[model samples]
Target: MQPNAESVVVLDFETTGLSPDQGDRAIEIGAVRLQNGVITERFQQLMDPGRRISPFIEEYTGITNAMLADAAPVSQVMAEFADFIGDDNLVAHNASFDKRFLDAEFARISRSYPGEFACSLLVSRRLYQDCPNHKLGTLVRWKNITGEGSFHRALYDAEMTAYLWLAMLADIREQSQLELVPFELVTELSKTAKKSVGAFFSRW
Candidate 1:
């Protein structure tokens, strides 16, 4: 499916750790707004997760607890971010992971976030299956896309994801016959697959 102009918000989050439901929280959120394949604007913030930064997470993201001591709370950042997203489709590498953190943050503030989401990881698997490694770093290098900052930072990774998403779209167009499906349909199929897998496990 071809993405419409200004229809996508490519986003990423830097969190204290994985599993937002387990008390982890987003320490930073970043996103790039895209209109017709061009990035029109960006949003980024360091969030006060209201917890101590773990040494492992700090070493990974280079964001210390002290750095976020005065940062805005997740509620405020998410509010501003929700405004930026504005009902547009969202994109991320490993999107469900990021969405879990975002939804958890929103839940904490008693707000709801509902929108269409896309995963660049799935797109990469669909379009570049020959590549042995589908990690963001590996895919970025394989696609010859240059990332400005280190990995794990929200904005930098989001920027790279945006580029990678565009490139994957191009690759899919070049290689596939499924050219006319709507973006919404692609997203729905992905979500359905995830739910089917989850339901299977729950029943097991």
Candidate 2:
């Protein structure tokens, strides 16, 4: 059986750099657990990557090296994060980026998650084609979703992404005239051709 959008955890990561392969590490992770479409729990942590973050990264994410200097180590943070994740499915905007870091960090602790991941960015691209773009902030403005008036921070981005994910699920249900929108259908929508999206819905 497929999970509902209401029951997944929405997560975001702020990292030292783009790829883990390049020795980049996640300095922070923020996530919210949704139950029946309401946020029931939250998790946020900043970890010491054991290296000074670049000036550009510091400016871009507003996460200073000093802020991370006293934080817990990566292994401790990831182990706690793993407990927070438990068995829920995951959602993230631009999930590929977050997923890479998540997998890399989990590997450090020899941990793994069984839940599937869904990309709000990909699903939004297919669902909101008329929108100028599908970036998390842009979608918040387009959909009139309330935001905390900040971006690039881990928890705030996860919060916005969570709202955006819910909006897309609502759009799908309203447009398809279906009462329930399965997580499987949302993932499928991400892969459906743009021109054939309407036809794809009919098949459901």
Candidate 3:
């Protein structure tokens, strides 16, 4: 697929804990839909996981159990989010974590959700290896990207990743010269690959 600024959905989730397989669930989900490098829309929601919120997680995200008592369940939120993402590629920092949670939620709802995904962490490591750190906070400081909310919140983190992805794209274009490379080759190279357009590029 063409890796243009458009046709991407930057997503993030705040969860009750680390392992969804252990019954951990998403407490919040957020995404920013972009078209041609501009955000066309956004989605953010607090989800009631029908479970208790551990004090550690609550403190970290400032989302107490009380706050989510009236929130919608993951099944409903995930369906809405799936529609928001449509057929576009999904973007996230350490995307597998988010994808796992999303996939598990879909599985619970008896719905299928297998979609293309891009990891900003992987992208950052490939494109900005010279930088000392690729952590979201470090990148924000290094790139001078401003974020409005606290860390650990889904929407804020997704927005931060979106901005970081844009900056990383600029770096990639400058280094690789807009020649399209298959995401698989980039994966194999452990970095973004430089390829002749005629030799690479595939539609997802």
Candidate 4:
């Protein structure tokens, strides 16, 4: 996805477990629609995976099986989420994990989104090396992204991640003295060596 795109869907999924390959599935989906640097809309759903959530999963995400009991089925929820996503690019902390589940879930409903996925975690690792970790919670605390959402919850993490994405873009704009941060700049930044980021962007 073009990092500089005016609109993007920042998404996060709380799954029954890690690795969809091992039969795990998403229990909750949360996302914020960010357009022109503002969150204009939001989408969230608790899904039923046709199974009980593990104790650890329940505790970690605070999404109880009881809460999901009356929720929509996984396939039904996935279909609606696909519609909510429309064609917007996606952003996530560690996007690979989310992307994997997205692909898996969408396939169940014969839906797929072609937008590119960008990893804020990767971008942060390149931009901010002083931080001890690049986790969403770590970035939230390090950058002081103001809010009252707890970690592990999909909506809160997605909201916080959206703020963090904007913060980084703002930093880039002020530092480069550019009208708006270029999407290519962030794409390149994600692939650039940490030590070379400053020099690489300098030439832009």
Q: What's the number of clashes in each of the models?
A: 2, 0, 2, 1
Off by over 4 Å in 3: 1-5, 179-204
Which pairs clash in model 4?
4-183
Question: lDDT for model 2, on a 0 to 1 scale?
Answer: 0.91
lDDT of 1 by residue, 126-187 (tens): 55657888899999999999867989988999999999888876654444334433465446
lDDT of all predictions, in order shown?
0.79, 0.91, 0.78, 0.88
Write model 4 residue lDDT over 1-204, tens digit each, in one string: 335544689999999989999999999999999988999999998999999999999889899989999999999989998989997888888999999999999988899997888888999998789999998888888998899878888898899999999998887776677776756677667888989878876886
lDDT of 3 by residue, 1-204 (tens): 545554478999999989898989999998998777788888999999998999999899999999899999888998888777777778888888998998898788877645577788876676666679888888888889996898788889989999987886666555556643344444433443534322332322
Better of 1 and 4 by TM-score: 4
TM-scores for every predicted model:
0.85, 0.97, 0.86, 0.95
* Model 4 Cα shift for residue 163 (angstroms): 0.3
Relative to the unseen true structure, what is the C-alpha lDDT of residue 191 in candidate 2, on a scale of 0 to 100?
91
Among these predictions, the greatest lDDT belongs to 2
Best by TM-score: 2
lDDT of 3 at 21: 89
Per-residue lDDT value at 31 in model 2: 94
Lowest-sum lDDT 10-residue window in model 1? 195-204
Model 2 deviation from the true structure expressed as Cα RMSD, one decimal place: 0.9
